[model samples]
Target: MTGNAALTTPESTAPQSPPEEPSVTVSGSPGETRRRAGALLALARFETRELLFQVQILLFFALDLVYVVLQMTLQEGMDDYPVLNQVDRATQPEPLLFAIAVLVCVNAAVLRSRKHGTTQQFDVLAMEPWRRTVAHVLSVVPYAALTALLVAAEYLWEALKPGAIGHGSLGELAIAPLTIMLAGIAGVLLARLVPSGFAPLVFVIAFYMAMVVASDAAAEGKWWGWLSPLVFPAYFPGDPVPADLLGRPAGWHAVYLLGLCAVLACVALLRSGGRTRAVKVVTAVALATTAAGVVGQLPHDKAALEAARRAASETPEKVQSCTEYDGSKYCSFPEWSGVRDDWSAVVDRVQSLAGGKAATTALTVRQRIDTSGGVEADTYIEPATTPGQVTVGTRWGGNRVPEFAVGVATVLVTGTEKSVLQDMCDARMVTIMWLVLGNDPSPAKTFQNVRLDDSTEGSGLLLTPTDGIGMTANQSTVVNELLERPHAEVAARVKEHWTELTSAATTTAQAARLLGVEQPKEAEKCGE
Candidate 1:
């Protein structure tokens, strides 16, 4: 008999049966072979759950659409600014990204936890071990795929934006997804093997942390910063990444993720001492991988030093042009202007000592725009809003769902308002109204029928004075400060450094309803 009828599981190399000789029936058991085949098939089906990332995929498309719209609406000659601004916005992060992550992780964890609610680990103890284990793993495939898809979509959209370079190449594409894949795989592995909600939660915090670091580095076009892969980890910079510094390519990231999946799967297989050894081996391999990654980046530092030297050789800073200036916006760094080659340490020193907001090169809101052609003078702002229905995308597909509405409208800036006391009073009133209207009905298990409470509603409408509304609980200090400052001075300061107190900027009608006051013509804008 042909012995090729073995190896029932696709991923496994183990033999399934003993072959017979010359038509003599020689087999361990047909039942065992059939069982292994079923398990392998189930595992394949389980992996197909990646299709469900459609929800995250849908959201990816939606966010990209917003990014596109923002990119498009930039005033003529302002394309580069939007892309740069987007780069910066992608850095610090807003709550929206966090919420999306939380939703994906929590939901995945919940699904995994229910199945193994009473064990150190989820015991896939069944007559058909393979099939059950596959099912358990398949459960989190959607979340993992969705997370990966969303990161990819955002990175691609950013790279494709007008004036976006470095993104057109294949090498550019793989860098970012590799990091995201690692992050998502990490989350999936944790949720799968940890058997607690905390696993996914910690994974998400780490994921966001990585993104924050990577995004910050990208904003500056610093090649060395690619190592972070911490917050917003992706290597898809629209710039040429030199070969010397590109040690950890996206392929390595994929290997890392696959290895992670293997480790997590082993957790389900480890029911006894022998299987536990497999876990140890996998853990050791993972640790070794981490060490390798660290070693790979060491040479990057040397490469950066060499590149800096070459740059200095080509364009030596002109020592003569080092004249003094007002140092207000353009500090007296004139001496270092032409002598960049020698001013290596000088450049770092001045930037460090210049102090916040007053630094020679301030990254605050500025009016300079650099693009494909040249620079321009203009201010670009994209009205990015989370629509009523938010779509999430996955590698497999996408899904659109209703969003929890959040908007903030300005009632009045303390100094800019006709009446400081009135702004405060009006803000307080509006806040109370919103709290009542926007009350969450679910926690109380009631429809949106909760009575309007002065306390909660006030909290909702009152935006920070920095933006437009709100004050209370011995509000004398704040009110007095606003009252003391001139309207023009206060308004100017407020406009330049505004932070939203209210998360949800409501419409005029919404604001009106919140205040129980007639709609004021001035408060027409969503964020007055």
Candidate 2:
């Protein structure tokens, strides 16, 4: 009866079942994966918008504008079209500036939760820690896009200007965006370790200074200098950009930079919570491997860099297009054929002025626009046509006929110098002046302390003229006397003695005597 009463009690009366076992299932599915990816992208977009609103972005634009202004100011006196130079100078500071900007932006974004005392809130969210870190790194894409647009605009503006010469290709243009992304990723990884607001700024500044120093050193061919992002090939005024400057080093550098970004991202990912020790160790090893790969891909020696440049510049398909005029072969790159007509006219005039000596010289004249947008010429007595023929070359900054004429004259008389070399140089200058002025003695009225007869102390020829003052009183007097005579007579005398006048043995005094003009003596001391 007692057992029957116990069975009817509350414990027995309540219906009881077997204890429920917790279901074990996969943590994520396809849909959940998509949702996580979408969340990361959304976070990246949000961070990008926040970054754009910062006052420092405006400061960045201002600094870039200042750089452009400074370049424009400095290019005023340059003889070549300033477009390429302006672009070069304007973009010269890009890597450093963008790196600093991205570093600051990424640091602020990565440390936002901590700075705002929302770490606990962030911890409570179901999102994976690595995804959050990746989102911050992905924010660099938007910044890079905006920067690329601004850079394109700058280049487009230059391209639209009259006489503008565009420099760099689309591939070269990718440098800035890539550099920005690398810097931002690196900054985020650094923030994961340092976590202080000002620390990243200090790091970026120090990095920029180091890059500046390293780039300067790289210009001198130090292999380690190539480690800096700022070490790019540049074209200065009067110097042509080498065809090899945009070659394999660039591609290798891109790979190295991307590998470094990956290593940093992996390191940052490992810093987050919930990663197992095994996962951490595996990631650490990956980071080391990638870092080694980045280093290995770099140009370890100057010779390797040079070889890459040579390969990039090589144009095996380019063939010389030739036109015969006055028994000479005038050859040029096919793309440069547009200047052939003008060059032909100049060659004919020079040959006429030089008379029979040039007619029999079997000259081969080749013209090309060098990588730096400068006019360069190679003139030689063709070996197949003439033995002991001279080879001469000249590079000039502009495309004017006068410059080409001077180059031709300089080439023709290159190796014929004698004891009276200074006198011959003065005579050559006078001859060039006559060809340039073409019976316009009126231009000589604007004269100053022109010292035409003096030789430069070193190997270079002295051709000094400031502003409109290109001649001294003595030079002006001699030029006027020569101009007053009949043009036909002067032409005859020059043609008759062309070879002797170009020879080093012939002094200015001798040439003047041959032309039946009295040579002017040096002016008496001013105070004597």
Candidate 3:
């Protein structure tokens, strides 16, 4: 045994030694061992072909390609579907791909568990350390190549097609490889690390749930939804959305996810360590590090985020003070600037009435729900899409105040009372109606530190802040009453509507109290 210490490359050359005397195992030269390892790796690819994981990967690839084909066909035929009319081409592709990727990850987890365990087919290879590692890794090669091809074709097709990205640019496709690579790594790495089947199942289920929840909230215009970076697709076709509203930083979020996959991959590496305490310590550290990495770059910019949040809630008056001429198309309402002191009273009232979300401002959205009419009106009234038609009482570029509130409780009253108030300005109902139901005073009142029921408007509504005392009992009745009836019939039906519409200016003292006061504060012809 001592004479053969330098050793032959094969175990077949080993000599027999006494049972009591331990035999010294000969380790080959480093360079030779490396060459042998490369040979073994190449051999592992042969084993990979026989592995069931290969079949699973191929099945998924075929299915994915087929699904893509089906989707393309359906989209082409969407002209026959009413629902597809509103389907945004730029926005729809992202969610579909993300959902499929998540499912693949789940399937991989299931197969990896069965593959690594006491499966008869893999048991022979599992007994050999190097063979197991190389073979398992090689199994993922097909999936990786297929995924790369899928992404490449998607971008290439989008480019070849005319006018693919307009409202939201699909330039994000440039980063698609990074995202897909990270996601694939995460899926495979998780399956490798937690081959228990249950962990990967739980992991993917939670990941998908978070994604869906985030998407729903974003659709509703909620700010919190932006925190879930996964909701947006890596690439979409449309005009470039603003950086301010990119939801979350895709690169940073992807980094966090990749870090998680690294930790899981390390866990898989140590699984063979055999109940050692050191293995336990390694696993614990990797898990802790992973958790930290995922949330580590969590915005320390609380102040910046707060500024964004506040800017979202601000009135035009407040926004004007902060404007630095950043290349934005929408500008501030000049007259509504720097009125902090004026809002002191209004803020108190809003705090009292606000409910639901912990941050009232979150609920008090500075939204512009552009109706079909609003879109049409925007053509004739350029300002309709600008600050002029805003019901939010705030402007992105305006000097909207940091402080403001509304008296929500006071707005609801008897039909007679509401109708009486609504009639004050037959033309100006919508704005004044918004003033009462909305969260802030009009920018026109920003300087005055008061609220104004500027004017109102109405259509086939039984009763709205826009309507006057001629309250039709129901919305259908109101529409029917107006359909063929003369103006005289409508005028005769509304009671003391003019007196009620114009009374708010004289009766209500606070800007918020304009809800209680009857009338359109401004005499402008508003209803259209």
The numbered model that scores best in TM-score is: 2
User: Model 2 segments beyond 4 Å from truth?
Assistant: 1-27, 62-92, 150-172, 212-222, 232-238, 245-248, 274-326, 329-404, 411-421, 425-428, 439-473, 476-528
lDDT (10s digit) by residue, model 1, range 1-528: 346656345746665676765744334478766866676667546544542344664565356446545644553422331232234324222224433443454336435536656543545554344344445445444444443455555555555654442223333333333433343444444554565666666766775677677656643445445455433424333322222222334334334435544554555445222244545697678656655544443344545645543332222232112322233121112211222221222222223322223233321111111122111112121221212111111000000000111111111111122222233433333332222222222312111112122232112223221122333322222222333344444334332332231223443333333323344434222222
Query: Model 3, 292: alpha-carbon shift in Å?
Result: 8.0
- TM-scores for the candidates: 0.37, 0.64, 0.40
Instruction: Give the Å shift of residue 272 in candidate 2.
Output: 2.5
RMSD of 3: 16.9
Give the residue spans of candidate 3 off by over 4 A.
1-30, 47-56, 67-131, 159-207, 210-240, 274-297, 300-528
**C-alpha RMSD values across all candidates:** 21.3, 8.2, 16.9
Residue 64 displacement in candidate 3 (angstroms) = 3.0
Question: In terms of TM-score, which candidate is stronger, 1 or 2?
Answer: 2
